[model samples]
Target: MNTRCLVVCLAICAGPTFAQHIDIDPRKDVANLTGEQIYTQVCQGCHMPDAKGAVGAGRYPPLAGDVKLASGAYPAVMVMNGRGNMPAFGPMFTDAQIADVINYVRTHFGNAYTDSLEPDDVKVFRPPPPSNPPEKH
Candidate 1:
């Protein structure tokens, strides 16, 4: 990596997205965990163990083998859109964690799969968080 590119990449990845809405799993990608484990650890409470992740009347849509997240369009939509009750994990989880969770969901849930959700991939999805309050320093 050259200095200029290094600087650019550094500028892009200098800091992690700081947000109050996302929850990143310390463990890399939920895929490393069992289906039930992923549920109890990160999803169960909201989506439920049955994959019927419905929070209520259209709150959390079921993430069963129904949602077409594994499409060519990119799973970032499901994560970034904050669609319905689905919150974006771009900031909360480390890139690895995001990849893990996404891989888990893509294989276990996304019916018609196309790709694997990598951490490097998730990193790109995070379009800077709403400008942070001016630094105190």
Candidate 2:
């Protein structure tokens, strides 16, 4: 057999094995994480380790020295509902987690806004459940 054919055959055979080894649970609860922990685990992936944000295929507005974070509610609403290219994290994170991450970002990365957000504040921004439930066939 040609080397090209052998490589393709090996890849096809190994793909399922590699996939099966991945044990990530998308719904894993993160309710207990601290503000910093939540930011590191979730927000840093896009916003970056330094929280300076990034720009490429999409722009992640820099969290550092951002004037918008002067209003705690603004970041809270953005995290819960998302805007433009950002995805809504309301479904994945609890209200507390959302509040924590927002607070973390607001206070860190050269941002010094001091009014902290409580989980109650974040709860208000969460979208209400759908009025009509989808029926499962």
Candidate 3:
């Protein structure tokens, strides 16, 4: 009940609380960041500035440089499915993040797919998951 004990107890209990800070730069784009700023911060590390994927498992694919994106499957599905070993960004990225990344990929890596994806498009089109096998009778 003493003031010194109370202060010491509060400090002990609040240890690590003071160190936690969740500050993050506000997102500037809805889709993945493509410019040097956002790219270097989030995409360039795994995807290389040229959009070339890495050589290991879980290595991200070469964004729009790959032909799979141009096909009718739609960019939204790709963002959601995350082929090879890339984790599904749907849960992690906002609609804008999805759009920005998709936009960056489509234009980078010497790729020619020039369509700018809208957040609404990404929001609506989720790729279908693989079907489950039938159960034995």
User: How would you encode candidate 3's per-residue C-alpha lDDT over 15-105 as one tens digit per residue?
Assistant: 4352133223223231344434444445555666676756643456666458877742366686666655443556546676677766766
Scored by lDDT, model 1 comes in at 0.51
Which residue pairs collide in model 3, if any? 30-96, 30-97, 31-96, 31-97, 31-99, 31-100, 31-101, 32-100, 32-101
Q: Clashing residue pairs, candidate 2?
A: none
Top TM-score prediction, candidate number: 2
- Per-residue lDDT of model 2, residues 36-114, tens digit only: 9767756776777898888766777789999999998998888888898676777767888888888888889999878
How are the candidates ranked when ordered by lDDT, highest leading? Answer: 2, 3, 1
Q: Candidate 2 or 3, higher lDDT? A: 2
10-129 in candidate 1: lDDT tens per residue? 333343342112333233333255434544555555666665655444455566785556452365555544564454545544566556655666666545465776656766766766
TM-score of each: 0.54, 0.75, 0.55
Query: Which 10 consecutive positions of candidate 3 have the poorest summed lDDT?
Result: 21-30
- Specify the highest-lDDT model's number: 2
Off by over 4 Å in 1: 1-39, 55-58, 72-74, 109-114, 129-137
